[model samples]
Target: MKYPALLPFSELVNQLDQFDSIIDVRSPAEFALDHIPGAINCPVLNDLERIRVGTMYKQVNAFEAKKVGAALVAKNIALHIEEQFLQYPREWKPLIYCWRGGNRSGSMALILAKIGWPVVQLDGGYKAYRQHINTELSQLIGQFQYRVVCGTTGSGKSRLLQALHTQGAQVLDLEKLAEHRGSVLGDLPSTAQPSQKAFESAIWLTLRKFDSSKVVYIESESKKVGNLRVPDHLISCMRNSACISLQLPINLRVALLMQDYAYFISQPNELMKRLHYLTPLHGKEKIRHWQNLSEQDLLHDLVQELIEVHYDPSYLRSIERNFPQLGGMPTIHLNGIAELDFLQLAERLLAE
Candidate 1:
């Protein structure tokens, strides 16, 4: 094969494993929004430089912008070669892309090719890949049979998914992918959610790896998880699919929630701040009461009240409205929230 061969989106998807590295040459800001899975950013023009070049292109002339862009691209590529790419053997193959199959990626591909490394440049670049994902997700989401796990808050839906996954079941834990537990207090301390595009990319990648003939277990999530919106087609498919209702005793549910949200207990002030978001719905007085529970270290009482007052009602309403099929679904009742309990439940589910 010729060095620096240009491959279209179709070929690039099939031949992904052939490349040693997937390098994204767009600005870091653009890369952060979304890139091909496993692709590393090695921007030819960084965020600020990209802005400067784009401003020049609009304010000055194409010729002038190209001159400045060329210089910036050349310098950045040189630095990357020195700092990052110097250790690669001659056999190292890389797939490179930019916003479009344009100069930024082209310049890097040309340099790497000149150095005798095999390179594949993605034609139509990240834009084409994005389009491919959109098309694939639209079609692929409907191919598999989804088993939506329905439960009230603190009912161990996510834990059930984890257990199912351990038992070799296909499970799409959207909350895990989104890094949020899908509630007002769902935010994880010291962890941030991925961008919407990144979240969708994660969903796309996971779906691509599944066997379409097998049933995929998933949680009954809303259209949004944390700040990220689940793709419309995926959410739609899940809503229309079969459901498995998960239930635990209220005591167990509270214990599970307390375990899952231990960070809040340790940091009562943060818990108070999160409870404040409920003010509009519960009124300031009710929210203040919950906050007082947090301050008084009445976490068990607080969790139980939150479940009864906020989560259960909201979840029941959402599930009833969104998942009509849940009217006659199989319900799995658990006595305890132990690992062995979930594992046994997962085995029974799979056996059925």
Candidate 2:
């Protein structure tokens, strides 16, 4: 059968609600790295099969590789039909794509059309959708006004961002999206961060939904959040945007760090390993001192020392240099890290 009708990525994004599902027919690894935001993986060739087919094409010939790949694609498509598409009505519609406007998506799209469902292949496939996101993001990010949340470590900035989001204030929580806290000890316990492409996709998905006229609150972060980078345009906008500097008592900040990082206290060995990353900056002697404190269960004193000697100095330098607008930025001081303190702070921020 001839290949199915092709829909441009731009048009597909607008009419996304009409489709029952957006199916990605690429290998699992490709989909894992990135794909359309709402698209589900329905690989015509799984990862192992793809590697086998590529090796065959390289060592043997195209015809022999196609022969093996065709059988695998047919079985996978039949399984998808039986397991996934069985409940869909005859008139159901789905948009399909692969890495490029190619045979993989074409094969499944043709079969779905024959089964009496409307299926359209993405014209340039995932590549086109990715390009669209990159292009659209530059414009979308520029349209919004931003209020950057800035503070030293353990000043309750992230918690305040969460409260603001819960209170219906517009917020872009970069750390939540990156799954990292933007610091040396930022990595979550066992969770792995997303691929750079997937991270960009998450940012693009969020940017499209925000109302441009309203102020979007975000935390001040370095160019890179863990391994993934904040989009260049977003970083630039945030650095130039207005700032809200949060302040808390040093003792309270130390207590907040203990609560936030309670896991480190329970796992002394892990805490020791994470502290080693600071050796280059603070010297072996200082790092050893911190390690000894962790081993002796002296987290309160250790946290206070780190805050005063490490985090605060770095934060001050970064904010002053990167965010020029913050030179005379308004400050919000908090007496405690309790829920009530943040709630009142959120209300005040909203009023300003």
Error of 1 at 331 (Å): 1.2
Taking the tens digit of each residue's C-alpha lDDT, what string does model 2 give over 1-352? 2436787888778787788899999999999888888889999999999999999999999999999999999999999999999999977888999988578999999999888787889998888998998789889899999999998999999999988988899889999999998888888888889888888888888877888889999999999999888999999999889998999999999999989888887778888898999999999999999998888888899999999999999988888889978769888889989988898899878987
Q: Which stretches of candidate 2 lie above 4 Å from their native place? A: 1-3
lDDT of 2 at 192: 88
| Ten contiguous residues minimizing lDDT sum, candidate 2 | 1-10
TM-score of each: 0.97, 0.96
Q: Pick the candidate with the highest TM-score.
A: 1
lDDT of 1 at 46: 96
Each candidate's root-mean-square deviation in Å? 1.2, 1.8
Provide the global lDDT of candidate 2 against the true structure. 0.90
Model 1 weakest lDDT span, ten residues long: 10-19
